[model samples]
Structures are given as C-alpha cells and as structure tokens.
Target: MPEKPPAIESFKESTKSPESELSPEVLEKVMNKVQDINEAGVAYSFVSGGPYSAGSIFEQDNLQKTKLVRILKEGLLGTPEKFYLEGVPPTKEQWAKEAQVSLRKGGRSNVYFNVTGMAHEEETPNTQSGETWISKSAGSSKKNALAFIFDLSKFTYDDDTNKMSRKYYETYYKRSTRKFTTAYGFNLSHRVPPRFFNGILLKLQDNYQYDQLAAEIGILSEQVYKEKGNLLLPIYDVYGNLYWPKKMSYEEVKKFVEERDKNKE
Candidate 1:
C-alpha cells in the first residue's frame, strides 16, 4: 500500500460532519445492513471508471476520489480495475439505447465489449478540404481479452432527470425524496461473471451532496441481489490496479479490506 494522498486526507477531515445533520435512524439502518453483508461471506472487488468518454481513474475529481476511498474504508477489497473506451465518442441516444439493453440483460452486452488490438491508420479523400483525411480504425487484433464496459449514458447530466428510476429508491429506501440530483450513477459493468457476483456499492454525484449515504449504501437490498444471491461490489484503489475473485478468495479479500482500513485509522 502507498501513502494516503493529501487530497484524500483532506476529504476525510471535511466529511466528518455531525451525525445529526442527517437522519440518525436511517444512517444506523444503512450501517447495520452494510455490516450484515460484510459478514455474509460475500466476495468483493474494485472497479474504477469504466469505458468513459471523459476522465480516467488518475484524473478523477475530488468527489469521486473521496467516494472510492470511503468505500474501501467500508470494506470492499482488492485493487481497482480501470477501464477505458477507444475511438470516437458515441452519441447520447446510442448510450441510452445501450443502457436499456444493459438493464434488460442485467449486465453489459457483447456489442460494447472491446478486444485488445493495435490501431490501424488510414487516409481517404476529404470532400470539404480536398485533402487526404486521416483516421485510425477502431477495431484491433493484437491481443484477445475481456475489457470492462459500463453504461456511460446514465452518468451524463442529460439523463439525470429520467434515467435513474425512482422506483428503486421508493422500493428499497422507502423514501420519495429524489436524493440523487446529479446525473452520475454507479454499478458493476457486464465485465464480471455471474458466478463470482456479490454486491455493488452504488453512488451518484448528487448522492454525496445530499449526504444520502443510506440510499447509496442500500444497493444490496435491491431485487437483483435477491435473484442472483451472488453480487460482488466493485471497488477501486487510488493506484487503479484491478482485482477480482480469480486473484483472491472472498475471505482473503474481505480481510484485506478490513485490515487496510484499520491501518489507515
């Protein structure tokens, strides 16, 4: 482990608000649920930003960085995997369509999956400039491996109003208040297999602003967990190294997260 960064240290101090600011009952309930899941023998892993048009793990804002650290302290284990997309940016409509498909399939579809390969440069006639147009082919063939994919459409400000289903909060949290203000949403991408699934630590941008920690922490209570019975929470470290069940057992990973938290304290 490396030294905790100064920005994260500042974040820790700043987040120490009085508990009375929020509903203590709700806070305690969320904490209890989190404790129960942590002891339920569920496996855990970390996933940073996945295939986004903007921002990488290393370039995350303070809020995002703080959220990653806070979740790690809460007990998620392993190095965080950093995912990125290649080629031209997709339109908002395209992303919305993909989100619908991802929700329907309960994971990422193969349409978004990218295989490792090299970029091929090519030139063509430019009608406007009367010069050769240069561009690189999106597909590659150097190496064949799985790259993590997530629905970026949900994260954009345009989708903030209608994208996040209020039914989730109404059913799980039992609160009608729209806790999430920003368009940001969080979840495990389709990259993780079904067998090793545990749970997800979901958070939106305005989630922290409203200090809706309980709603954010209540992801395990979702219906998907009931159906799957195995959903691993994806986490990310400051260094952005990805970890999964293939590299460590659930017990080992859990212990690692707990120990790391203790040391930080």
Candidate 2:
C-alpha cells in the first residue's frame, strides 16, 4: 500500500483524535473494529459529530425533513436505561416507520435490508443543531449508519439500518434556531457517476476488486454526462463542483476507453 498522502494523514489525525476521546477501552475497540472494516475493504466511513441526516446531503432548508425528526423525538423510542443494550434488533413496526420517513422526504418508496450495528443522534431544546453516527451494518446493505442527538447534556443514537432513510450518521455545527438542518457524515444514497466512481474511489489499497469497480469510473462519468448532464459531477470533488465544462457523451467516453485500453498494448 502507498504511504498515506500528507493531505489524508492530516485529515485522519484531526478526526481520529478528539473523536477517539471516548473512554480508552471503548475507543480502542471502536477504532480496532473500524480498522478491521477498513482492512476488509468494506464501503464505510468512520464518522463523528455533526447534524443528523439521511439520503443525499445535497440541497438545504428542505421542508421534507420534519417527519423523521418528529418521529424520532416523539414517536417510538423505547425507554432508555443503564449502560444501554449490548445489541438490539429492529421490530417490524420500526421498519414501517422508516417507510413513512421515506415518503415524507420525497422518496418514491422504501426498502429494508436486515441490518446490525450501533448509532447515536440527538436534538436539544436550546441548541440550533444536532449530531449522529449511523454505522455501516454488517448485514445485506453493507453500511448501516447511526443517528445521534445531544442537548446541552445527554447524548443518544438510534439503531442502525440499511434502508434508505435520512439522518444516517449526520452531525451539525450551527444551523438556524428558526429553520434548517445539517449533515455530518455520509449520505448513503449518494453515489458518484460511473466514470468518476473510479476516480473518487476509497479503500483501494485493501482490495484489488476496488480497482475493478473504479476502473470503469470514467465510463460511468461519461454516461452521466450524456443523460444527466453535469448534475452530479460535483459528487467527485465537492458539492456543486464540476471538473469538466459539461458531461461527455457515451460514445465519446466509449472511444476514450478503447483508446486507453489500446495504450496498454
């Protein structure tokens, strides 16, 4: 594996330290488990602190978020207790609740995969924003994320799930007391176009298959350019950034792929 680039090393250092401020034993276990997941080339992000969010982290001040937040605060949370549970499973009722969240958030439908993992999310009476951690589930969907909330005092999270709902591993620094929300970690439904998928790939050193998936990123990018224009190009860099003037067409990309493949000869 290549040495950590200076940029990524700095990023890792900042996020890993203060976030690891949890108790020594818990922190050790958390990092070790995350490392194991990293080594396994699992598609996941180790997130800490920020707004509670779900789905694409694009767009802001969305009116569609009220349902998930309301349900989380006032709906079906079970009683909290000493030391929390070692592990808990989701009930069918909770799954149905997720579907409702989907509709409220402008999604066409809801789908659930069996999942397992821990997460935390919270909203406070006095504060403008909240935070969460939606773990990647080891189950069918791969990365089941967590949601969390912290008032001036208490901190708590929701059970992780794979179904496409919002508030997955979200966190926020400052939002409006009057309106809006922020997302801390990753947006699960967020995906890069095929062409740039390879370009923005993560966890490559851990597995060769990662290369296979990303090797065609250029092709995917071309496809997106043809059909969707530059709508999602910024996903590779940052939100609202386009590396190229506009997306390229499929035929143009196909020719580029053929030319690149021939160059290996």
Candidate 3:
C-alpha cells in the first residue's frame, strides 16, 4: 500500500476560500493568459559582492526564489502600495514592529519555532543590509527563527489565481531559500529576470536530486493553483521520520522533510 498525504493546518487563522480543483495540466490559451502574468526575473538584488546566498537543503542552490520571481512577475506588477521601505536591511525590532503588522507576524518567536536554524554558517548569514533578510527572533535561535527582509511594497493581490499559486511555490521555496527580500512590505517578493531564477531551481534539482518526480510536478502544481483552488501531490512510497512546526520537536522537522527522499523500497 502507499502512504497517505500529510494533512497540514495553516498557521494563520483565516480560512482560504474554497477552490475548484484543476487537472494535471492546463489548456494552451490559459497558459498564454498567465504567460505574460509577471515581471521577468529573479527577486535578488546584490549586497556587498553579489547575490547573497544561503545554504540550501531542499535545493542545491536557491532555485525556489527564481520560481517566486516568475509568480510575482504576473501578480505584484502595478499593484497599489502595500507600504514603502527605506533600505536593504530593514530596521530592527523596535522600528520594524512600528512599521507594519505583518512584518513582525511570522518572524522568529522561540528557539523551537525557528525553521531556518538547520543551515551551516555558510548556508545562512546575517551580516549587513540591502540584500536579503536574516533576522532571527528575540533570543536563542531554536524557536524564534526564520530569516526575512523588512520591506512592504513587494506584496500584491490578484483576481487571477497566480497569487495563490505563487504563494504555494514560495512556500516550498522558503523551506530552502530562507532568503526573503524586503522592499514593498507584504512578504517575500521582488522583480528580476528568468535566467537567474531558472538557474537557482535547476541548481537545486541538480544538487540534492530527489528520486521522486515532484520537482517537475512542482512547477505545474504552482501553475494549477494559479488557475484553480485545489492542489494534488504525488505521494511517493517513502516513509522517513516526522516533523511538525510547532507540534513536533526539532528532531521531528528534520525527519519530516527527510521522509520525502528517504524511502525507496
């Protein structure tokens, strides 16, 4: 027999609207409609040397960010101002909290809460500003974790399903990139190019290289949510360990992510 899909509840309280399910693929015209949907580029801006990098687990490099740029290219373009940011490195706690409500909402809360602490020093860093955010929560890096930039203008909404789809891709991407850009303010978003974005995802799939076909499906699942509300996943017959954001211990998260690639027999 096969393992069942993992059921997850969203951290936030609000209910996402119900959506009609989509098939494994979309028609040609629908593809064309969303083809020119977003700005063409990666969301990265340079820091001191070039694109600041964080080590990745889900990907070899930061390919998830590239997928993000593509999603937002269509959605965040020409939207109203969510908020305005001042610089590359957003101001610390006191001011960031004062700026916007959502900015500090998802930040590191407790040592156990932190999901970004798994990286080696090379994969994660918080040196300066202007590139991406590596802001850890108040104290001990265990619970209060996750690195993100402090900008507001980068967020946008849409009548089309791109926002939801992009968000889904970004959700997977954040697990690896952890590299959040701050500018407009809502959350992770930016405007760059396709090559860098493509390069990142390609590098990730090339690097760790999972055996399942989820990577190919990931691109399409991302697009499907753009059209319909529901998503389907290819549950490979692999059982590793288990992890929960708040429910499980650190050991659990490690096991949970590992499960996707661990079982093969």
Clashes of each: 15, 39, 33
Residues 153-204, candidate 3: write the lDDT tens digits: 2324333433322321122233244432222112232222111221111111
* TM-score to true structure, per model: 0.24, 0.22, 0.20
| Top TM-score hit | 1
Per residue, candidate 2 scores C-alpha lDDT tens digits across 1-265 of 1212112122222221222223454333222211111111122231111232223111264221332222222322321221013222233355345446645665523111111112222321111111111112221122212222111111112245354444332212122123111222223322111222111212222222222222233233334344433221211111111112212222333354466556658
| lDDT minimum window of 10 residues, candidate 2 | 234-243
Model 3 residue runs over 4 Å out of place are 1-248
Residue 110 alpha-carbon offset, candidate 2, angstroms: 11
Instruction: Give each prediction's root-mean-square deviation over alpha carbons.
Output: 19.3, 20.4, 18.7
lDDT (10s digit) by residue, model 1, range 16-90: 333333345433432222211222112222233334211222243533334333333332211112112332222
User: In model 1, which runs have C-alpha deviations exceeding 4 angstroms?
Assistant: 1-17, 36-40, 49-83, 86-96, 99-265
TM for candidate 1 is: 0.24
Error of 1 at 127 (Å): 65
